[model samples]
Target: MDVATVKKKVIVVMGATGAGKSRLALSLASHFPAVEIINADSMQVYRGLDVLTNKITPAESQGVPNHLLGNIDPSVEFTCKDFRDLAIPIIDDVLSRNRLPIIVGGTNYYIQALVSPYLADDVVEDMAEDSRISRLTDVDLNDINSASAFKLLNEIDPIAANRIHPNDQRKIQHYLSLYSTSGILPSTLFLGDTSRKWGRADNFRYNCCFIWVDAALPLLDRYVNDRVDSMIAAGLLNEVFDIYKPKSDYTRGLKQAIGVREFDEFFRAYFAADSSWVNSLTNDQVSSDDANMFTKPKLSGILNSHDSNTLRALLIEAIDKFKANTRKLLRRQRRRLNRLKSDFGWKMQYIDATKAFQDESDNSWSVWVVEPCVKIVRSFLLEQPGFLSSTGAPYNVLHLTSKDLCTQYVCEACGNRVLRGAHEWEQHRRGRVHKKRASRLNKCQRTFSVDQQAAKSADGELNSTFCNSP
Candidate 1:
């Protein structure tokens, strides 16, 4: 079967949040003589935020040697680069021990970093010595507007600047700092450096299979909704409430999990609910200052003056928002995976997991999941392009990694531009700001739900969920 046809190896299972990629990886471990699964998930690296993050349970590990799960406190920072630094050595160690390394995670960016080339720590340290970024860090970033800063960056490093979005303030600032400190543009430094340079696509160290698990949109929507319901039934609310602090910043590591942010409006109301109605919702007292954390203006506006009935209604709405947001994230993940294939020439073995998922308590997962995965992995390793053609994914190019696809989006209606990728587009299309502009421009009736009106506007039906966000 040419199972060993691939080079120094690793197996990465990547997919959306609820697509069962972790389960598939564990099931596949049974076929290997020895395999260690390393965590590449950004959220799962945090110690708490377990149920909300949909962390793999101990029962689900199946006695497999798994690394990096729940290893850090949620408050600390972790980045894609940090993930790559931690995972690459593990991959090397597993290979030295004659064991395969299988990395399964919902974070595609982390997986990309794990496999792609990067600068060595020493080289990075060397670059950091008297580096522009190092100098700029101590300066007040707020003093410069993003537009002016990006323009300055463009003058200094137009090639890199063109590739980086103007709205990406952090990257723009970094570029400016690099130019100011090193006296060389970032693009020039990256390309021209001959000694101890960070790795690029041409530098990836492993011969591996990147398994992309996906499903049709309707099936994915159902899966996300069902998972959200399961999370609730499994006490997701209390799990979040237990670890939550009124002062916790969402910019921190684990706070970025989809479940945490989507439930913000409800938590805010519960925190600042009317004293007369507070007992109806909770036995504990909450401070009004906590209300400052409520940032979603649309949702906040709906629950004006948080009364008992209002809090209860917002609770139901939070559930729907959670489902909607998760569904949206799944869609975004699919888009990113496709972009990964296009940009990095990732040899993706696509799995329609909705078809593979089954109710088999007595039947081993090998039959339903592992067998099919083995077939795909073997085909990929053998370089049998036609083998996966029948599975709707074919190995074509096995190439190097490049920068991620740009995330810039421009709104013609409102001049609301962002570098936040698909979510920005989703929010703009589904949000009230754009709809209001459209209503005034086209004279379409301003309705309670933009999705309903959009469905009607597109065809003669209401397509997506009718939950409207203004």
Candidate 2:
């Protein structure tokens, strides 16, 4: 039988960056007899720099076979298509040996493309060919800046734009080019169930269970802060220094990794005796009038005449920026997980990884995490395809997403403050301050997550900010 016709079901463990995805993936491997894990995290695929990528140590893998972890050379550009193209055969091979496949990570885009193999087929191929030219012409994200780019795309294709991150310039450009070339709304093409789009294939083969290991914002925020601190203590700076101590620039793929780029500007300033390196950034001279059109975060600088204490303060600011940006990344990933269920119709079950992580000392891993997930997997194995609830009623994304009562809007676009409730957020969304920021999100911010803790509203416009002018 073709792999698509095979009844082999795979498990996907997805969540924000610090939500214990690797820990839970390992636990599931111990619970199930023949389970292998494939890394779905975009950063972890690159070889070396374990601390920055938060790579799983050998001790943590517990002898469960894991594929695609720290395997790629960092110099090569790795895309979602690269991940999907490489992962499909390995998944089939593992299933052929009667081993269960567990895909785990924070990179939902990688998981989305892997699950929907053809999702990246045209967009990515076109990008590779037009990468530089498109960087200059209409889809040239570098010329437009991400915020204006996001707003323009949102106005044109809100449905497709909903899935993209505002700061994701490449995807924004790809979608723009895709629409310009095909004249089809990317949201319609990617999210629609028609054969003309990318969705559950008519030849849909795999029995898949997507488990979202999530936590409350307070708990998750604490977890992210602590994790960043731990990574730094465990030698993240050393890993960075090994590469940048020799002065490697962004042309190398490793620099694109989150933990590194956040510190890139600061490192250049610290190492150089003069501000000569700033020239490298300004090499592409546009007309002075056009310079203000770009909205990337201004690389703040410490005064050259300032004392050592001032430079130390600048370093501290850089560290804070890294931690803050990491949280924003997790928040974006959380939104993507919800979109997987809401937009693409993926049946994602929720598990409170915080509870599981806290309950480990009580030896409740099997009880809280492994057993619950396995029970669902066993149902699929028994040909109990999960199209409806036990009562034979079809389910909606609202049913899976709406239990938490502490809903609030996190407007990174506004000022990174959590709006007290849905009404306050709706007001803020319509407020002039938010509308201005929403159009050109500062580098520190991406899109706003209004009513982040609540279920989707009836109109399916939960994330909309005011697009109309006053």
TM-score of each: 0.68, 0.66
**What clash pairs does model 1 have?**
117-199, 118-199, 119-198, 119-199, 201-401
lDDT by residue for model 1 over 37-143, one digit each (tens)? 99888889889867878888888887898899999777766867788888878888998998878889888777766765654222444665555442334445346
Tell me how many residue pairs clash in candidate 1: 5
What is the per-residue lDDT of model 2 for residues 120-177, given as tens digits with 9 covering 90 to 100? Answer: 4555444454343222235544456667878888888887676645666767776776
Write down the worst ten-residue block by lDDT for model 2: 292-301
Clash pairs for candidate 2? none
Question: Candidate 1 — which residues are off by over 4 angstroms?
Answer: 1-7, 119-124, 130-134, 137-202, 274-308, 357-368, 379-470
Task: Kindly report the root-mean-square deviation of model 2 from the true structure over all alpha carbons.
Answer: 13.6
lDDT for 172 (candidate 1): 75
